[model samples]
Target: MNLFADIRALVISALDALAAEGALPDGLDTANVAVEPPRDPAHGDMATNAAMVLAKPAKAKPRDIAEALAPKLEADARIAAAEVAGPGFLNIRLASPVWQEVVARVLREGTAFGRSEMGQGQRVNVEYVSANPTGPLHVGHTRGAVFGDALASLLEYSGHEVTREYYINDGGAQVDVLARSVYNRYLEAHDLDVDWPEGTYPGDYLIAVGEALKDKVGDAYLDQPEDVWLADVRDFATDAMMDLIRADLALLGVEMDVFSSEKALYGTGKIEAAIAALDEKGLIYRGTLEPPKGKLPEDWEPREQTLFRSTDYGDDVDRPIKKSDGGWTYFAPDIAYHYDKTQRGFDQLIDVFGADHGGYVKRMKAAVAALTDGRVPLDIKLTQLVKLMQDGEQLKMSKRAGTFVTLADVVDLVGRDVTRFVMLTRKNDAPLDFDVSKALEQSKDNPVYYVQYAHARVQSVLRKAREQGIDVSEAALAGADLSGLTHPAEQALAAKLAEWPRLVEIAARTHEPHRVAFYLYELASGLHGLWNLGNTESALRFLQDDPAHSAAKIALPCAVSLVIAAGLGILGVAPAMEMR
Candidate 1:
């Protein structure tokens, strides 16, 4: 039901026919030809650049090629006219019934109307929200979590076999810090005074993990040394924090298919195996890095460490796998995790990290490049910081003040739906402002409200139509006399409906789910425009005096609601059936 693709295929076949007649040179590369909507609606319903692309290759003027191709295109009933533009552009005006047919097609397909097979069930792994198992997730991790979860949903809707995964960084210094923080809480549980240290987590959220540890093994490790209790407490505290993370994600309606532990990668020979695989490719070496690009640190000294020749794969310099103290660097476990992903035989990989990790992108990409030898492509998306505002003032999140915003705070303030939609309104690399006041406003200025209102308005029309005894089921609507839907407003609404399938393909191809959110807003705008037209023009109304005529006109807006529901579904935003 993709009119654009259908027309593009027609243009390609027409070019093949031209080659058969020797009208144009045989084998002029047509891969670059594009069929898209004309910039100006006056030009035509669709436009193609086939003639222009084949002109130089076929050794013929573009106008001559367009003129020759016009007659060939006119033979199809769907194309009303194929006029040659300034040079070689072929401007096509589709018959009114062509777009009218799209409305009926949408009604028949319902939410499945714009679904695409572009992914074709190829396995894809998307790793996001790899936040360390510390306290509750903060604002920054929320953006990445929403973005990655929505992307996984979008890919699955478009037919990709997607795995939603989170990499728990528990095997790091941070988790030990969490353990010590819990240790302090454990001492606090024993009614003893403890001073909060500088490097330990000072958040109140860890107090519960401490209390729970006291409940599990009450006062047994109260006076024990760090070595005697560090491992047991670290394991217990990390598990509790992960449980908290899972609950926080559930608050925002997110569920990961897998939770990969960095601890599992350690002591399993998995890191060794992954590093050895890279070593087989000559990517590993024992070397010392030159001082960083500008000034060298005062403590900088040349020291031999286990390094990876990342520069060979386009990194700025070689990377250290093991620190000078004979322990793995932070990147060692990361590389091993990605290697695990590659060995799982996924067709592609996508990592969603915070934008602060921008410097690490080149090295990680180089690691994947060398590990898989470019067999699997890795797409890393960095989510920028999300700023919080309220009442014309910056909302300070000082952990010491116990005033930091948690994911639960945001979700509880407005809602999970508003939180998810607002986070997705901007690109992953662009900063997002989540205003508590503006997000809750019930006006068009808020996209979450605007798009949801559109779906609700359409539902109102359908409910009214059904209450009046008009059959508005999809089966009945599919058979409506759609040709009666010829009003300018009706046709404009139909045009928006045609863009859904194309939008799905574009969003999936680029791994950008935010585009779906943007498209939903535009679609809602078009719908609201048509709904408003009913105020001044009687014909623009969804339900007219004539039941059959009203059915035809009603189909357009109902289709609009259907596509909005689909888009909202991908974004994990619930579509409203009535404005609250």
Candidate 2:
């Protein structure tokens, strides 16, 4: 149960009672009223800003409103005290039984304790890691992949029907470059001397693909012209690279529900349909854009091109949808792709992009807004770069990837669980420095280890209880007499446990999975704190002299493990049952 939500409801009920008695203004809007934990724990268990926010609207002094509301709240069986703090902020202290009930509820609910229905089953499409199918996914794409996958999982945990998607950039010139590069490698396979060109991919990863192409074709394209082999080799190389990418994603536990192809949009009338729909709204025009803001390039010209009036939807300027040569511009297919998504009837959309795409955000938003006629909302989250370091030095590039470290390299070095958890230790928009040595270290500085250790420690306590002939099952602990868990440390951890549901709703609402990671670290810290206390305070230990007392004491840490497992599950991490 969300204790904060319950208390906020109680405050609303009290405010309604005041309005009923004419002690406050009639029809006072209480939407902004909030009940949350006090910033300083010494203040109280919870605090509300009902009086402060409603003062001007209700035409009453905040202190008078708080003073009138205090008695009504205190009269409830849950509230121990409702004290009026500075500036009419009402601080509330719940009875000890409230925290006790939280522990029992956690035990009863298990890992489902924090699951929420806030999304109301709305369909959401989360598109991420749409790297070009030309080579292995690099570290930058890894950050986006992890962030997007975690976000999709977070949405699902909140009851959204989420589809994790990858948009293949196969329709671009890059794929053609990939074809030529593979052809060069193919000639090398046939014992031909090939000079490496500047724009061709020279990575060794394509060597196997080239050899495979030779095995299949067997001299069919030998000494052929560009037209005869370009299309066939492009298709073959794209498929092979995609296979490599799929394997790389598997290394990090990432899977896509849909892999949409950009090439499918070409020669299929999808791009035309998307642009025509926008044109029907008077957004398309033949116009020349203003020269970009700095020194104009020597080849710059005011050529009339097919443009979308993106400024109408808040973009800085109109955007080109087609070139003067009558070929579709890069943005045309993207608009079509999102239009395709909207047609699939998703209520909302989220695109996870690398930080380098920051410039493309407003234009894409404007396109979705125009395409949906402002019906659907699109959120673009740009994940910042990840700096992989080891022993105080930046790690070198991967030989296979040629220029950058592949996602597979990182996963192979640190493992899927550590790679995923460490990627989200910072906000999606913040730069993350993932130190390999630190990630593997069993120390508090390592967030993933610290969180896992908390879960493992609880499992150890439960195992000890089991050895002492105590029934440590969830049903038994849930039915235990938890009244004895009144120590300051125990109470504090229970309070933290009470915050899980609230935290889930907040993180899901903000589309930030980093909040879940941060909360897990704090909750783990709380459990660790209580575990340390048991060393000096014998009565606080889980395995006590009396079975009943032991059951009551062990229930708190048991609930802690349950919640940790739940949080880790959202992050796609398997909680460790024991540490080495």
Candidate 3:
């Protein structure tokens, strides 16, 4: 149960009642009315701006309106007091039983306590980690992978039908380079001397793919010309690199529901169909783009070409769909891919891209807007760079990846849970400094450790209670009388638990999964704070002389652990059963 929502509904009902009693005018819009935790907890449990928002529309003073509404709200059993704070804000303190019931509700719902139905089952397609299938995924892709996967989970928890997808960049010259790199490795596998060429991959990871190719076709393509082997090797090498990427993602607990191929869009009418759809709306034209701002390039020329009127949809300029040579431009396939997504009947689309692709955001949004006629909303999230540090210095590049650290290397060093949690410690558009030493630390400085320790502490308490012959099963704890949980510390922690469902909806609506990580850390801090309080106060301890009393006290931590586990699940991190 969302106490904030329930309280907001109560505030609306009070305003309606005031209207009926002639204390306020009728038909005041309450859409902007909100009930949230007070800025200062000392003010009240919840605060509302209903009086302030309705004052102008109701043709009444805010304080006058708040004064009239307070009595109507206090008449309800759940509301202990409603006081006008400042000039118009209404601060509400709920009855003590209300906070106690929040704990019991958490136990009954288990990890499902904060799950919301806000999306109403709308279909959402989340495309992320669409890195070129050239080699194993690197650190940049790792951030996008973690962010996208967590976002998909968050949407699912908030009742959106989500599809995790990866768009393979195989239709470009990059795959040809991959094929040639593998061919060099294939020659080395035969114990032959081969000169490394410019613009080809030199990663040691390709050594295995080269050896595997030899095993599959023994001497079949040996010493062959480019035409004879390029096509076959391109297909083979692309498949091998994709397998490596999949394994890398698995190391971090990410699995995609679909892997779309850029090459698949070619040799088909998909690109033409997508362009035709835009053309039908008069968004496609033959035009020459103006020279880019600043010093013009040596090869800059105003050439008439097939272009999409992206400016119509807020892009900086009209984008060319075809190059001067008559081949499809790089943006053509991307437009086609997004058009296919719109055709799939998804109500919404989300793309997780690396920070370097920030310029591509507007054009992609324009394409989807033109394709769907603004019917499907598209959100593009750019994950910024991750600076991997150890020993106060940046980590060296991976030998396997040749130029950057691979995702597997990070996961192998600090572990999957640590890698996933730490990646989300910062906002997606903000740069993150991931220190390996800090991530592995067992102190409060490490957010992942701190959060996990809270869950493990709850488990420890439950185990101690069970050993003492106090029944602490889900049903028993849920049914326990929580009336004695009146300590200020206990009430504060319960209030934090009541914010879970509301936080879920806010994070999901904003498409920000990092908020979940932040909330989990706050909740963990509250749990740990209360746990520390029990050391001095005999009444605060979970284990008391009376078994029934112990049961009642243990119920709060049980509820805390349940919420922590639920938050961790959305982040794709497994909750710690015990801290090592």
Candidate 4:
């Protein structure tokens, strides 16, 4: 259950009652009313904006409204004290049992405790990691993959039916380059000398694809003309590339629910159908786009082209959908793809793209807006570049990728868990500094290790308690007399435990999963601080002289472990039971 939401509802009802009693203006809008944790602990447990939100509408001073509303809230059994503080804020502190109920609720709910129905079961499609399927995915694509997968998981947890998707750009020139590269390898497998030419892919990952092609066709196309073999090779090579891409994603624990192909859209009338939908809405036209702003190219000339009136939907300018040659532009198929998504009956759309695609965001959003007629919202998340560092120096690239590190190299070096956690330690738009040496270090400075270490410590405590014949299972702990958890140190942990359900809602509303990582870190810190307290004060220990007290004290640590396991589950990290 969301305690913050529960308290907010109570505060809203209390204000409405005051309005009914004519203590305030009639029909005052309470939508702006909010209940949040007080900035200063001295203020109280939760603070409300009842007076601040109603001051202007009620034509009364904020403090006067707060003073008038205080007693109404104080009448509830949940609020022990509701005092007006600092110019109209009402800080309310409840009795210890009020928080005790929060702990019991969490234990009963388990990992589903923080799951929210905020999305109201809306449908969402997340398109991500649509890397050029020309070779094995590199390190940059790895970040995008993890970010998209985590975001999809977060949305699912927040009560949205999510579809994870990847758009294959098989219609582009990059696939032709891949085809040529595989052809060279095919010749090599046939005992013929071949040289990878300029602008051709030279990655070793494609060598197997060529050998397989040779096996299937028995060298029938070995000496064929370009036109005769280009299409076939392109199709064959793109399929192989996708196979490699899928395996690469599997290695990193990513799975896409759908894989849409651009080439498939070409002959299927899907592109025309999507464009016709836009045309019906009067969003399509034939026009010459103005030369790119600020610096016109020397060869620039106005040319008539099929354009989408993107500016009508918030883009800087209309974008071209058909080239002057009458062939579809790169963006035409994308608009079609998104229109296809809209037709699928999704309620929302999210695209996870690299930083270089910042210019593409506006047009994509405009397309979705026009496609769904503003009924479905589109949110684009851009993942910034990750600078790979080793011993404070930039890691050098390999000849295979020309100037970039491969994803396999990274996974092999740090393993997938460390790589995933460290990548998510920052906001998506913020650059992540992944220092190789630091990520591998098992110290407090490493957040992954620090959080995992706290979990391991809790496990150690539980093992110690069990070895002494103390019952520590959920059944036994659920029946513990938590009243013995009266020590301030133990109570502090219980308070921290109360924040999870609230934090999940906040993070989900903001569409920011990194907030969960930050919350988990703070929770880990609080647990570790309480553990240190036990060393200095014997009474603070979980194992008490009285078995009844021992069970009660152990409940606090047990509760902490449950929340940690849940948080780690969301992060896709394994919670260590012991540090090795």
Candidate 5:
């Protein structure tokens, strides 16, 4: 069903035939050859660069190779013409049956039409939204959550065994601060005057955890010292905050396959083992780092510390694994966490991080590279900040989550689907301005609304077809006479459908889920464009006077809905059966 791939295979066969006839040099590398949609539609339906790539390698002029190869491609039943364009580019116009077959294949495959086997069921671990479990998830974490969740779904759809993971930052000092914050709220629940201290969480979300702590052990810790109750309170508060985080993620249709705790790595041989593994590779040593380039920190001093030779694997400088105080640095646990992932037997790893963590990317990648000896590849995608606005005014902090807008607040205002879709409308590393009013509006300016409206329109056409006594089932439409679908608009729509499978493979290989969102928008626009064309052209309408003709026309919209549903499913957004 991938017309591009089929055409490329034909070009390769033609090249092999040419080489056998001694018309070209043998063993020419065609791996770089590509078949794709031509830049200008006027040129042809497809274009290939086979002749251009093989020209220098075969010691022949590109145009000579193209002219010889064109005749061989024209002999194929699917190719109407193969013209040599500009030096060596082969522009091909496909026969009408090629476009007709695209519609039929879409109907036959349904939602599985665009599914790819590029992954070959390889295991992939995607870790994201690894926020500190101190309070409800904030606006920054929401972008990572949506992006990571969508990426996991996309990999799964492309035939990878994906494990969605969240690495909880409960091992850090933040949890102790959370425990103290909860204790203050516990005192407030007991009617005692409690002063909110600096470095402690002040969000109202912790007030409930404080009250719950009071209910669980009333007056037990009222007079206890910090040493006596710090452990219990930290565990209690962390559990409560984790529960809140889970609810927040659920609001956006996100659920992790695994919740790994950084605290669990402490005192457990895991950190030592990960560092020891690097040490064996001569990557770990005790060294003093030079002053950072450009600007020096006020506290910068020469201090001996345990460092990982990250520069060996492409980092700018080796990074510290242990601070001067002899305790593990933050990077230590991260390295151990990735090592654990490697031990789990993943063929590849992807980490979705906040844009602020840009400095940590190279070191982390180096650690994984040194640990797995480059057997596994790690791709870290950084999601930039999200700016939320409403009614042309910037929204400020949320009192509930303390400093920033909580994910819950955004989900409550618009909705889960709208929030998820809007977060992905831009590239992950690019900042996004999320306007509440614009997102909720039912207009083309809003991609979520526009794409959903297209799906609903297709459903409406199908409903109308059913009511007109036409058998609009996939079996009936797939078997209809698609040769009548020869109109330019109809043929163009089918050609767009042919790009889905190839797009899926490209997106998966690049590990960019935003590409899927962009492609879905383009596909929806194509459907909408065709639907608008039918208003003035009665023959372009989905329902016709003859039942067979109506079935054939309705098949195109039905395929559109199927592909939209599949694409939205990858994004974790439910397809709209009807626009509200």
Candidate 6:
């Protein structure tokens, strides 16, 4: 049960009563009315804009409307007082039983307490970590992977049918370069001298792929030239690199539901079909793009090319779909891939890209809008770079990746849970400084540790209660006499728990999973504060003098543990049962 929503309903009922009594005009649109926590806690528990929203429509003054509505709302059993504040805002203080009931509701619902149906079962496709398959995923891709996976989980928790997908960039020259790199490694596997090419990959990770290729083909391709081996090896090497990427993702607890291939868009009529759909709407044309604003390219010359009229859909300029050579440009396959997603009957599409791809965002959205005719909404989230640091210094390049820190290296330095939680400690578009030493520290400076310690603290309390023969099962806790939970500390915790259901909807609506991480930290902070409060107060302890009082007191911590577990599950981090 959402206490905020329940209170909002009560506010709406009062507004309708005012209209019925002719204190307000008939048919006033209350859709803009909102009930939320007041800005200052000293003001009240909740605040509403019902009077301000209806004032002009009802042809009455805002404060006058608030005065009429306050008396009506104060008559309700749940509302203790409804005071008309500063203009037309109504600041409400709920009765003591209301906050006490929130605890019982949490214990009754457990982890499902904050799950929302706001999405209404819409199909959502979240595509993230579509890194080039030339090598292992780097630290930048790790942030995108964690953010996308958490977003997918948050959408699912909010009642969406989420499909986690990865788009493989295999239809480019990068795969050919990978094939040549593997060929050199294969020659080295045969104990032959080979010169390393300047542009080829030199990572040690390819050594295993090269040796595996030798095991599979034996001496069949040993004497073959580049022409004979390039095609076969390109396909073979791309597959091997994808396998390595999959294993790397698994190390971080990420598994995609779909892996769409860029190469698959070719040889199929999909590219042509997508373009034709846009062309039918007069969105495709052969035109020369103007030189980029402010600073033109050194080779900037007017050349006619096939372009998509992306400017029609709010893009800065029309983007080329075909190069001067008539071959498909880099964006052609991406257009087709998004068109395919639109045709798959998804109501919403979300792409998680790196910060460097910020320029691609407008064009991709324009293409999807032209393809779906604005029926399907597309949201592109750009995750900024991650600066990997250890002990006050930046980590060096990975020997396996040759130029960047591999995702596997980070996971090895810190376990999967630490890696996942620390990655989300910052907003996606904001740069994150991930210090390995700080992330693993068992102190409040470590957000992951601080949150997990709250869960562990509750577990320790439950274990102590169990040893004392207090029945702390969920069934017993749900029936506890929570009326005695009138301490200011206990009430403050229940207030924090009431924010979960509201926070979930806000985070899901904004497509920001980092908000969940932030909320968990705040909730953990509130929980830890209450735990410290029990030091001098005998009644504040979980183990009371009476078993009945203990049951009532333990219920609050149990609820805190349940909410923390639910939040951690959404972040793809397992909750700690006990802290070391």
Name the regions of candidate 3 deviating beyond 4 angstroms. Answer: 297-299
Write candidate 5's Cα lDDT for 306-352 as tens digits. Answer: 99999999999999988777899999999999999999999999999
lDDT per residue as tens, model 1, 373-439: 8899999999999987877676767452265678888887788999999999999999988888898
In model 3, what lDDT does residue 515 have? Answer: 96
Tell me the whole-model lDDT of each prediction, alpha carbons only.
0.89, 0.93, 0.94, 0.84, 0.91, 0.92
Question: Tens digit of lDDT per residue, candidate 2, span 7-100?
Answer: 9999999999998998888888888999998999999899999999999998889999999999999999999999999989999998999999
TM-score of 5: 0.98
lDDT of 4 by residue, 242-327 (tens): 99889888878888999998988999999999999999999888888778777568768888888899999999999998888889
Which residue pairs in candidate 5 have backbone atoms (N, alpha carbon, C) closer than 3 angstroms, thus clashing? none
Q: For model 6, where is the 10-residue window of minimal lDDT?
A: 292-301
Q: Positional deviation of 51 in candidate 4, in angstroms? A: 1.1
Rank ordering of all candidates by lDDT, starting from the highest: 3, 2, 6, 5, 1, 4
Q: Which of the two, 1 or 4, has more TM-score?
A: 1
Model 1, CA-based lDDT = 0.89
Report the C-alpha lDDT of model 6 over 266-377, residue by residue, as the tens digit.
9899999999999999999989989978765885788999999999999999999999888999999999999999989999999999999999999999999999889999
Q: Native-vs-model 5 lDDT?
A: 0.91
Question: How far in Å is the alpha carbon of 415 misplaced in model 2?
Answer: 0.9
Error of 1 at 471 (Å): 0.9
lDDT of 3 by residue, 1-580 (tens): 8999999999999999988988888888899999999989999999999989998888889999999889999999999999998989999998889999999999999999999999999999999999999999998899999999999999999999999999999999999999999999999999999888888999999999999999998788887899999999999999999999999999999999999999999989999999999999999999888888884677587789999999999999999999989999999989999999988989999999999999999999999988887999999999999999998999869977899999999998899999999999999999999999999999999999999999999999999998998999988988988899998889989999999999999999999999999999999999888878888888999889999999999999999999999999999999999999
RMSD of 1: 1.6
Alpha-carbon deviation at 232 in model 4, angstroms? 2.2
